[model samples]
Target: MLRALVIVPTYDERENVPIVVARALAATPDDVHLLIVDDASPDGTGELADGFAATEPRVHVLHRAAKEGLGPAYLAGFAWGLERGYEAIVEMDADGSHHPEDLPRLLGQLTDHDLALGSRWVAGGRVENWPRRRVLLSRGGNWYTRLALGIDIRDATGGFRAFRAEALRRIHLGDVASHGYCFQVDLVWRALQAGLTVIEVPIVFTERVHGVSKMDGAIVAESLRLVAWWGLRRRLRAAFELVVHRRRLRSVRANSSRVV
Candidate 1:
């Protein structure tokens, strides 16, 4: 039995936290536990999390002092899961963009994969209630990152994902530099580089109606810059390897032909 834990990062998401927690718990079997990482939202979300943790055996809470970036919160939660011997772990939003019902499907894909991504760019996935600009912005970012990273996984920036604990343990947490949405892209790229199998599970991303969205132009811009930088570095490394191989091949051919 793979003991799983869902890490939900919350900031001023008072109204939707309880609902999302319940739905996530109800949508899965009774064994999957949840850890809500609240960044001390002024909306009393931390207290609410405490109340729920008091009652639910599988539910836990980690209340931070202030609002930090999403990646750091999840990093903390990941460490917590690791310490407790969780076999698998997941990261999700408390604003309800990540559907609780989709957790099972993502987990199921892990049987044959090292990581399973809930992707919006894959077939059968959709976005709901987003403005035209938001859609275009997201689509453009996804396409740009895909080309820049030279990777094929759709929805590279999607946060709804499941990882085998051993795989996550292999990745260096200190080397993960991205502090925002781009963190997802960095992790996926690094996991691929480590020769781990990653599969996409189609999912719909819905805009939250009750709370302010954490997505911003700055995060998108940061993603573009970081991805481009990594892409250049990867390309340069590959070019160097190719040159070395070609030189070796030419030397071998000259020795073998021996026409002189």
Candidate 2:
């Protein structure tokens, strides 16, 4: 069995953390371990995680000083797993939106692809208990992201994914800047840029039943701003490359004329 570590980041998810951790442990193979990275939840989520880590050998906890952001928390987890020599690292939500049962399918796909994305927008993929407005918003956001980034991935914002350590290392996690849900988009874009093979597996995303959601208006705004900025930068880089190529062609022609 391949050695894998599932990194679940939590913030005030005291109610959901234990259930998610248990499910992840039961659902995955024996070789797969779970790491809970808690951002000093005032609700004592870190304490709860510590209790689990005490008895469960496969379980571990990393406590941060305060709520930093999803991106930083995951980066910290990834670094820890890499240092420990885990071959595969997984990203999962502390909330139940991402089912642990689907982990095997996602990790299995890593045999051929460097990244296996548990996509909620692909064929056979669906979401439960989501209102029509929320569904529309998610679909529209993914469409906009696909167009802006010029990536063919169907679910750019989905958080559930499995990454081969080799591919994750190539992405240079230090350079990642997104701190909100857009962190998913940023990493996928980076993987594509690094020439990593990315494949999506369909999965159902269910809304969380416990704890308050972390999404806010500011996070949404940040995602939009970053996506637009990246799109513009890509366009500008392309245009500059075109100009350089044209200049090189002109110089080559001038030299040919002189030789003639």
Candidate 3:
């Protein structure tokens, strides 16, 4: 049996942790384990997770000293799973935006692809309870990200995803720099660059009903800036490589002409 770990990062999500954890465990296969990565949520989210872990053998918790951001929390969770010999690692949101019932579908797709992304913009995918402006922003942001990064994924910023351990290893998780929502986009980009196959699974995204949203203007701006910077860097590196290749070809032809 391939062992899988569903990593849920939480911060001040005291009200929703138990429900999400229960649903995730119920939806996953027997081999799938759940790990709650809590950033020392002052709301006692960590305590709630520990309570669950005490009774459930499949559930575990990693309590961080402080809120270091989503990226770091996930990194820590991934490392925890990797060290424990899990073959697949899943990324899920604790606020219930990502449905645990869809976990089986996402993990099933991982059999043929290196990554399975639960996307809201794909066919049969939809969002529930989000206002028009929020929907438009998500759509436009994904469009912009695709244009900038040249990735064909419909929901590059979606948080629900499953990754094969080998694929994650290939991407070198330690070098990931995004500490916000852009972290999703960064991982997708790196996985593609490493020549891994990525597939999207349609999923319904729901607005959180229990707690405050973590999204902020600063996080959005940071995502935009990082995407633009990465795009520029990719272009510059390609241009430099082209120049170098042309020079080498010209030098080779010149030598051939002298020999002739």
Which candidate has the top score in TM-score? 2
Q: TM-score of each candidate?
A: 0.95, 0.98, 0.97
lDDT of 1 by residue, 175-255 (tens): 787888999988998899889999999998998989788888888788888999999998999999999999999999999
lDDT per residue (tens digit) for residues 95-172 in model 2: 999999999999999889899999988999999999898899889989999999899999999999999999999998
**Model 2, poorest ten-residue lDDT window?**
1-10
Please report how far candidate 1 places residue 48 from its true position, in Å.
Answer: 1.0
For every candidate structure, what is the RMSD over all alpha carbons to the true structure, in angstroms? 1.5, 0.9, 1.1
Q: What is the lDDT of residue 4 in candidate 2?
A: 94
Provide the global lDDT of candidate 1 against the true structure: 0.90
lDDT of 2 at 70: 95
On a 0 to 100 scale, what is the lDDT of residue 15 in model 3? 90
> Once superposed on the true structure, which residue ranges of model 1 sit more than 4 Å away at CA?
257-260
TM-score of 3: 0.97
Residue pairs of candidate 2 with colliding backbone atoms: none
**How far in Å is the alpha carbon of 125 misplaced in model 3?**
1.2
